[model samples]
Target: MEVRKLHPLFAAELIGADVSDPQNRELIDTVEDAMREYAVLCIRGQGHINDQQQLAFARAFGPLELPPGNNAPGVKSRIAPGLYSASNLDANGEIVALESRSAKIAKGNELFHADSSFNDMPSKWSILRGVIIPPERGDTQFIDMRAVYEALPQAMKDRIADLKAEHSYAHSRRKAGADADDNLPMFKYMRAVQPMVKQSPSGRPTLFVGAHAERVIGMDEEEGTALIEELLAFAEQPQFIYSHKWQPGDIVIWDNRCTLHRGTEFDYLRYKRDMRRANVNESGEERCAIPAEALTQHYQQLSKAEAAN
Candidate 1:
């Protein structure tokens, strides 16, 4: 397998390796190494991969994550329980109407985010395969947060160093006006605290704020959102971005710890685009959930304090 760097800041495209083969254990190690170094690895030309084969390759990174309840029931993905659909097509293989629930969910992808950041144990890596490609203008863009952090002024760095923020799927969903709560059992209302500046697995200090991040701890709502928006604006400089155009059978795997990504729109009404993704947790990291009891106590205390104030 030959690895070619796609950008100076982050992504690399690997040629000549087929990820679908289970016997190719050696490729997993190679890909992992590249992922750590490049942050984004696109393995081209695997368009014929079946759902089982895609799952097999994704699991090589770590255990898979189940789709969030927000995906809704009755909208079946080919690789369910582990794989999540990233497409606009419904279970019946027809393009969903623009105002439909599935389409609204897909619209949420327009915001820059790291997958599953609302979970205590956020996704370590994500693998996406393009099964059907639109003719033009549907690209997945990624940003290197490590590079973004490095480029920041020292004062800006110090300001965020000790800060923490809360991440919630509800916040992101609402951003795109996709909050049509269907009361699905799988819908986990998650809010987890993460360092505003986190140490990546590669040992670099990286910015962690994204679409799911609601507010910074200890800061008022307006102030916190302003700071988050400032950081987002600073990080989106073109030099740190890598936009990957889709091709059928293209497999793109990215390290979620140090990268932010968002899907670009196409002619959703006219074109059929099918993409499936699997999210994997870091090795040896067990699934973590914030205790409901603890959350309740914390909120009660906050309410009491506010009442006194």
Candidate 2:
């Protein structure tokens, strides 16, 4: 496999590897090593791989995260259980209307975030395959948090060295103008607290702040929010970013532990973008800061009460 740097700081294009070939242990090991060095790797030419194949490749890295059970009632997934439909297509293989709930929820993706940071056991790797690409203008931009941390002023770094922040999916959804309230299942009340600075698998300290990060712990609410936003703004600088334009058959693997990624806007109503993703959880025992089962039961009760009304 050949590796070409995509940006000065991080991200690379890895060529000549057939990720779909399960027997290729050497390729998998090389990819893992590449991920440790470059936070993002865009493996070229993987369009021929199916959903199962993609999942198999992702599983080579770590345990895959289960698909979220928060889909609208009666909307079944077109893909397999472990795959997430990161596309604008509905279950029936049609483009979703702009005003639909799915579209609204997707608006949150435009903001930079570390995948599944809201969960207690945050995601480690996200493998996304571009099955159907748009005609133009739907790139995925990534921020190298490791670079961001290195560029931070010493005093600024010291200020956040020991601070922790609360990351919430619901908060980001609401910020993006999506209807994320207590009516939703797991996201509404569940939150994860992570240190503002955490050690990445590469043994480098990376800033953990993102759109999902709501506030710094023990600080005044307004001040905490301001600080988080400031850090995010700093990370958004072009020096720390790498934007990847999608092409058919391209699979982009990113380490969520050391990077923040956001989807760019495209003409969603006019074009089809069938991107499938497999999220791999961080290596450890499965756990959640909030009780997932209790939250699901609460949502069910609310639905029942609303039905009776």
Candidate 3:
């Protein structure tokens, strides 16, 4: 496999390797090594991969998280349990209405975030495959947290080194002008407290703040928001970012532990952009085992209480 650097700081494109075959141990190891170095890796021309093949390849990293909203009643997903539908299409294979709840919720994705940061065990690797690429626009932009951390002023780094921030899916959605209580399985009132600076698997300290990060624990609310925004502004500088344009059959893998990503705008109402993603949890020891039935039940109760109000 040949590696081509996509950006000065952290992303690369790997050529001459097929990831569809999960049993290729050498290929998997090579990809993992590349991830430690690049933080983000794109393997183009993977349009031939089927759902089963994609899941198998994603599992090579670790156990997969059940896609959000998979437990919704009567919703049959084309992409299967382990893969999250990152597309604008509905379960019926139709483009969702712009005013629909799903579309509104998706607006939150436009803000940079580490996947599943609100969960107790945040995700590790997010492997996304482009099934239907739009003719133009809709690129995924990534920020290298490792680089961002390194560029921070010493005093700023010291200030955040021992601080913990609260992350919530609801908080980010609300920030995006979407309803926090939207009833999506993942949108429920859940929060995870994580250190602002954490060691990545690569042994580098990374800034963990993102859109999902609500506030720094023990600090005044407004003060925490200011700090988060300041760090985000610093990280948004062009030199630390890589924007990946999608191509049908392309599979892009990013480490959520050391990167933040956001989707760029596209003519979603006119074009079909079917992207599916499989997320691997941070570790096998702390794998999230939230039962589908339990999530379904919790949401049902929430809905009932809302209706009563």
Candidate 4:
């Protein structure tokens, strides 16, 4: 396989490898290593892979993260088993209307974030496959957090070296004004005291702040928020971004531990976009930050209360 770097700091394109071929163990190993070296990697010319094939390829990295039960009611994934439906379509395959709550909350994708960072054991990698591509205006942009961390002023780096932040799915949803307090089910995710910078296995430092990071520990909420905003703005400078214009059959996977990504606006009502993703958790690292049974029981009681009301 041939690798070409897409940006100066990170991201690469892999050529001459059919990822769907499970027996291509050598290719898989090479691809995985390339992913570690370059945080974002894309494989083109895969327009025909089925959902099963996509899952198989993603599993080569690690165990897949299934659609969590903690998702809100309208948030049911359209795909089977483990794939996430990152689409503008309903379960019936119709385009979700712009005014719908699901569409509204999905708009939060405009903000840079790493998938599942609110989980204590955050995602290690995310493989997204483009199924239906819009003609224009839906590019996905990625940020190399390692480059961002490296460029930070020494004092700034020192200040955040040991700081921790809280990240919450509910907080982000509420900020999008998607009716998180009422229509949304009780969210069972809240990650507290996550270090502001994560150290990768190779000793590279990556900035971990994003929209889900609500506040920094040991600082006033307002002060923490301002700092988070400032960091986000600084990190998103044009030089640090690599925007991928989508093409049908394109599969882009990025290391969640060292990158931030966001989706750009498109003519949603007129155009339909279909994308599926499988997030791989860190190998041998699973956090029961909130016990599954406890979250289930709490939501069960919440459902009963809502029904009675």
In candidate 1, position 301 carries an lDDT of: 55
Candidate number of the best TM-score: 3
Write model 1 residue lDDT over 84-156, tens digit each, in one string. 7888887788999998756886787899999888877767898999999999999999999999999999999
Please provide, for model 2 over 1-309, each residue's C-alpha lDDT reduced to its tens digit, 9 standing for 90 to 100.
Answer: 898889999899898989878669889888888899999999978878999999888877778776654333444778887788899998888999988767998999999999888877768899999999998999999999999999999999999999999999888898899877745556654578999999988999999999999989999999999999999999999889899999999999999999999999999989998999988886553333345575566558657866896
- lDDT-best of 2 and 3: 3
Per-residue lDDT of model 3, residues 169-195, tens digit only: 889889999877646454553678989
For each predicted model, how many residue pairs clash, with residues at least 3 apart or on different chains?
1, 1, 2, 0
C-alpha RMSD for every candidate: 6.7, 2.6, 2.3, 3.1
What is residue 35's positional error in candidate 3, in angstroms?
0.1
Q: Which stretches of candidate 2 lie over 4 Å from their true place?
A: 70-74, 284-309
TM-score of each: 0.87, 0.92, 0.93, 0.89
> What overall lDDT, based on C-alpha atoms, would model 1 receive against the true structure?
0.82
Between prediction 1 and prediction 2, the one with superior lDDT is 2
lDDT of each: 0.82, 0.86, 0.87, 0.82
